[model samples]
Target: MSRLVVVSNRVSLPDEHGSPPPGGMAIALSAALQRRHGLWMGWSGKVKAGEDPSGPISRREARGISYALTDLSQTDLDDYYYGFANRVLWPVFHCRVDLAEYSEARMSGYQRVNRLFAKLLQPLISDDDVIWVHDYHLIPLAKELRNLGCGNKIGFFLHIPWPAADILFTVPHYDDLLRGLSCYDLVGFHTDDDLSNFAECLRRQGLPDPITNGVCQAYGRVFRCGVFPIGIDTAEFERLAEQAARSETLQEPSQRIPGCKVAIGVDRLDYSKGIEKRIVAFDRFLRSNDHRIGKTQLLQITPKSRTEIPAYLAMQKDVAERVGRVDGELGTIDWMPVHYINRSVGPSELAGLYRMARVGLVTPLRDGMNLVAKEYVAAQDPQNPGVLVLSRFAGAARELGGAILVNPYDPEAMARAIEEALDMQLDERIDRWRAMIGRLREYNVYRWCDDFLLGLDQR
Candidate 1:
C-alpha cells in the first residue's frame, strides 16, 4: 500500500494544549493514519516571526500518530483562512453570496497560503505517497502541488455546500479557482447537490467538452470528482452514547426527562442551522399538539462555535431570545417545551443523551452532512429504535433516506413530522432504524477514507 499524506487548514489531531482528539473529521483521518503509517500536515494555530520549518515537519506524537503542524504569521492567517477562505470562498461555496467579501487582497492571500502549503508539502512528498487535502481552505492546493511537479495521486474534499453555478458566480475569480481545483486526481463532495454545483462550474468555465451532464462526473480534467458522503464510526459512537448515559453531565437531564419521550436536537450554534426556527416549531408543537407536551420533551444542545465572528454573536443572541420565548410560553413547572444548552459535552455524555431521545430532530436548513443524525441512528436501541426527523435540505438526507424528511422552513410541517415520528409504529420504526444503522456501520469513516484513497490510487 502507498503512504498517505493528509493536509488541512487546521490539524484535527491532539496537541499539548489539551484539545480532545476531534470527534468526527479529524479523528476519522487520524485513525486512518494510525492504521496505515502516514504524515498529517496542517497549521499549529500559532504565529512566530522568521522560524519556518521547511521539511516533513513532525510536531508531536501520541497513540501511533505523528502530528505535524507549521506556523503561520498573522498576515498569512488573515489572508488565507479568515479573509479569503472564510470570508470570500466559504460564503460563496455555501450559497451565502450576500456575505462573500471579494477583494484582490483576500484572493492574493488565498493563493499565498495555498503556495505556502505546497512549499512545505514539497519536502514531505515521496514517489509513492498519495496526497489528500481536506476542505475548502485548500482548493488551490493540488494546483500548487502540480506546479511543484507533484504528479502523485492528489485528492481534495470540500466539507461545505457547493452553491449552484448561478450562485457560485457571486465570487470574483471563480474561473481561476475552478481551474486550480481541476488539477486534483479526485475531488469529493458530501452530497449530489454539491457535486452538481461543482460539475456545473466545470461546464461554465469551458473545461473540455467531453462531458456527460449530471450531478456528478467521473472526471474533471484528468481527475474524477464524486460524492462520498461521510459517515460516523457507528460502534464508537454507540459506545460513546452508552458511556454518556452514565456521565455526570447528562445525569441532570436524564433525571429531568422523567420517562417522557425525548426529542433531541444537537447542532453547532450557526445561523444556517435554523436553530431559531426549530424553537418556534417546538413552541407551536406544544401549543397546538397539547396532548404530547407532558409526554414528550425537546432538548437542544448547541455547542458555541465561531464566537469571535459578528454573525455568530448575532446568532447566539437570536437563539437565546427564541429559546427563552418558547420556554416562557409553554412551561408548566415540570415540562419545558424547549431546553436550550450552549456548550460541548464529551462523547460519552452525548451518547447517553442520544440514546434516551425517541425522536432525533435534525433539521438544519443546509448542511454538508449532519453527523448528529448518523450518531443518533448509531445510538438507537436495535430492539426498540428511535425515529430520525431530518431536513430535506440537509446533505445527510440524501444518504439517510429512511429518515422522516421535513422541510425546515415550514414550522408546521416540521412539527407535524415530529408528531408522526413519535407516533410511528414500532415495527416500522425498527425496520427503518435497522436499515439506516446497517448502512452507517458499513460505510463508516474508515471506508470513506479507503474509498477516496482507492480512487486516488487509480491516478
Candidate 2:
C-alpha cells in the first residue's frame, strides 16, 4: 500500500495523554493515516513574533502516524491566513462578493506562504507517497510543490462552496487560482452544484470543461473534478446521543425550559452562517402565533470564530444584539424565546441537545456541508425523530432530501418552515429521519475519506 500524505492549513494533533482529536473528520483522517503509516503535515497554529516563516519543522508521532508541523511568523499569519485566505477567498467562495477585501500584498503573502510550505514539505515526501491537500488556504500548494520538482500524485478537496463564474471573477487573478487547481491530479467539492460552478468558471475562461466525465484540461494540465459530499461518523454520533439522552446532563437542561418544544441551531459565529436571519425567523415564528410564544424555544449555540477579521468581529456583535432584541421582546418572565449560547459545547452534550429538540434548525446562508444537519439526523430518536429545517443554499441540502428546505434569505419562508417542523406528525418525522439516516449510515466520514483517496490513487 502506498503511504498517504495529508496536508491542511492546520493539523489536528492529539492531546497530551495521546487521545485523538474530537471531530469526525479528524478521527477518520487519523485512522487512514494510521492504516498507511503515513504523515500528516500543516501549520502548528503557532506564531513567532519575528522568526522566519520558513523555519524548521516540528515532528511528532502517535498511534503509528507521523505528525509534522511548522510555525509561521506573525506577518505570515496576518497576510496569508487572515488577509487573503479569510478576507479574499472565504467571502468570495461563500458568494459574498461585496465583503471580499483584496490587496496585492495579501495575494503575494498567500503565494509566499504556499511556497514556504512546499519548501519545508518537499524533503519529507517519499516517491511513492500520495499527497492530499485540503481547503481554500492551500489551493496553490500543489502548484508550489510541482515547481519544487515533486512528482507525487496530489489531490485537493475544498471544504467550502465554489461560487459561479461571475462571483469568482470579482477576485483579482482568479485565472491564476484556476491554474493552481489544474496542478492537482484531482479536485473535489461538496456537491454537484459546486462542481458545475467550477466547470462554468473554466468554460467562461475558455478552458476545457470538467462536466465531460469530470476530466478537464487547463494550463496544459489534465485533472479530474468530482463531487464528494462529506459526512460525519454517524454510528459513533448516534451512540453518543443514545448515551447522553440517558444522562442527568440532558435532564437538567430539559427542566429549565419546561413544557416548551425545543428548536436548535448550532453554528460558528460567521456572517455566512445566517445566524442573524435565523434569529429573525425564530422571532417571526413567535410573533406570527401568540399561543406558540411560551410553547416553543429556540436554542442557538454559536461559538465565536475568526475574531481577528473585521467582518467577523462586526457579525459577532450583530448576532448578539439580534439575540438580545428577540429575547427582550418575546421572552416573558417565565420563559425566554431564544437561548443564545456564545461559547462552545461538548459533543456529547450537543448530541443530547439534538436528541432533545423537536426541530433541528440548520439554516446557513451558504455552506460546504453543514454537518450539524447530519449530526442532528444521526442523533435523533428513531421512534420519534426531530424534523430538520435546512437551508436550500447549503451543500447538505443535496443529500438530506428529508429536510424541510427553506431559503435562508427569506425569513417569512423560514418562519413557516419552522412552524411546519414543529407541527410535523411523528410518522412523517420518522419517515424523513429514516430517509436521511440511511444515506448517512452507508456514506459516512470513513467512506468519504476512502472515496477521495481512491479517486486520487486511480488518477
Candidate 3:
C-alpha cells in the first residue's frame, strides 16, 4: 500500500497523555493515518515574527503515524488565513458575497502561503505517497506542489458550501482558485448541490461540463469531482450519551429546571449558524404556546470563534442582545425562556445535554454538513428519542430525512417546526430516530473516510 499524506490548515496532534483530538473528523483522519502509517502535516497553530515560514518542519511520531507541523509568520496569518480564507472564501462560499473583502495583497499572501507549504512539504513526500488536503484554506496546495514538480496523487475536500458562479465571481482572481482545484486528482464536496454548483462554475468559465460523468477537463488536465457527505462517530457518541444519562452531572441541569422540557442548540458562534434566527423562532414558539411558557426552555450553547473579525464581533453582540431581549420579554421571576451559554461544552456534557433535551434545534442558515444535527440524532434515546428540528439548507438534511426540516429564514415555519417537535409522540419519535440512526450506523465517519480514499485511489 502507498503511504498517505494528510494536510490541512491546522494539525490535530495528540496531547502529552497520547489522547486523540476531539471531534469526529479529527478522530477519523487520525485512524486513517494510523492504518496507512501516514504523515500528517499542517500549520502548528502558532504565529511569530522573524521566524522562517519555510523553516525545517517540526516532526513527531505517535501511534505509528508521523506528524509534521510548520509555524506561520504574523503576516501570513493575517493575509492568508484571516484575510483571504476567512473574509473572502468563507463568505463567498456561504453565498454571502456582500461580506467578502477581496484585495490583491491578501490574494498574493494566500498564494505565497500555499507556496511556502509546498516548499516545506515537497522534500518529505515519497514518490508513491497519496496526498489528501482538507478545506478552503489549502485549496491551492496541490497546485503549488505540482509547480514544485511533485506528481503524487492529491485529493482535496471542501468542508463548506460551494456557491454558484455568480456568487463565487464576487472574489477577484476566482479563476486562479478554480484552476487550483483542477490541479487535484479528485475534488470532493459535502453535497450534490455543492458539487453541481462547482460544475456550473466550470461551465460558466467555458470549460467542459463535468456533471455528466464527474470528469472535468480544465487547465490542460482532467480531474474528478464528487459528493461525500461527512458523517459522525455515531456509536461512540451514543455511548457517551448513555454514560452521561447515568451520571450525576445530568441530574444537576435537570434539577435546576425541574418540570421543564429542554430544547438544545449547539454551534460555533458564526453568522452562518443562524443562532439569532433560531432564538427568534424559539421566542415565537414560546409566545404561541403560552401554556408551555415556563415549562419549555432553550439552552443555546455557542462558543466564540474568529474574534478578530469585525463581522463576527458584530454578530456576537447581536446574538447576545437577542438572547437578552428574549429572556427579558418572556421570563418570570422563576423562569427564563432562553439560557444562552457563550462557551464550549465538553463532549460528555454535550452528549448528556442532548440526551436530556426533548428537542434538538439545528437551524443553520447555510452549512456544509452540520454534524451537530447528526450528533444530536446519535445521542438520542431509542425508546423515546428527541425530535430534531433541522434546517433544509444543511447538507445533513439530505441524509437525515427523519428530521422536521424548516427554512431557517422563515421564523414562523421554524417556530411551527419547534412546536411540532415538542408535541411529537413516542412512537413517531422512535420511528423517525430509527430512520436516521440506521443510516448513521451504516455510513459513519470511518466509512466516509474509506469511501473518499477509495475514490481517490481509483482515480
Regions more than 4 Å wrong, model 1: 15-22, 49-58, 208-220, 243-252, 257-259
**Positional deviation of residue 449's Cα in model 2 after best superposition, in angstroms:** 0.3
Worst 10 residues of 3 by lDDT: 47-56
Candidate 2 per-residue lDDT over residues 1-459, each given as its tens digit: 899999999998988876678899999999999999999999999887675655579999988889999888988888899999999999999989999999999999999999989999999999989999999999999999999999999999999999999999999999989999999999999999999899999889876544578888878888899889999999999999999889996857777867889999999999999999999999999899787989899999999999999898999889889988998887889999999999999999999999999999999999999999999999999999999999999989999999999999999999999999988898999999999999999999999999999999998
**lDDT of each residue in 1-459, candidate 1, tens digit only:** 877889988887666753437576677787777766878888877775653522235567766666678888777777777888877776676567776777898889889888888988888779888888988889899888888898888888888888888888878877777777778878888887787777777777665442353223323455677778888778888777667666676667757657678899999887778888888887777777878877777889999986756777888998999888777867778777777788986677778888878899999877888888899999887788889999987888988877999998999998888889888999999999987988898998878877877777876
lDDT of 3 by residue, 1-459 (tens): 888999999999997976678899999999999989999998998886684564458999999889999888888898999999999999988888888898999999899999989999999999999999999999999999999999999999999999988998888999999999999999999999998898899899887665568887888899998889899999999999999989996757867868899999999999999999999989988888887899999999999999999999999999999999999888989989999999999999999999999999999999999999999999998987999999999999999999999999999999999889988999999999999999999999998999999999998
Query: Order of all candidates by TM-score, from best down to worst?
Result: 2, 3, 1
| Cα error of candidate 1 at position 384, Å | 1.9
Instruction: Name the better of 1 and 3 by lDDT.
Output: 3
**lDDT values, one for every candidate:** 0.80, 0.92, 0.92
User: Candidate 1: worst 10 consecutive residues by lDDT?
Assistant: 210-219
CA lDDT of 215 in candidate 3?
A: 83
Cα lDDT for residue 46, candidate 2 = 84
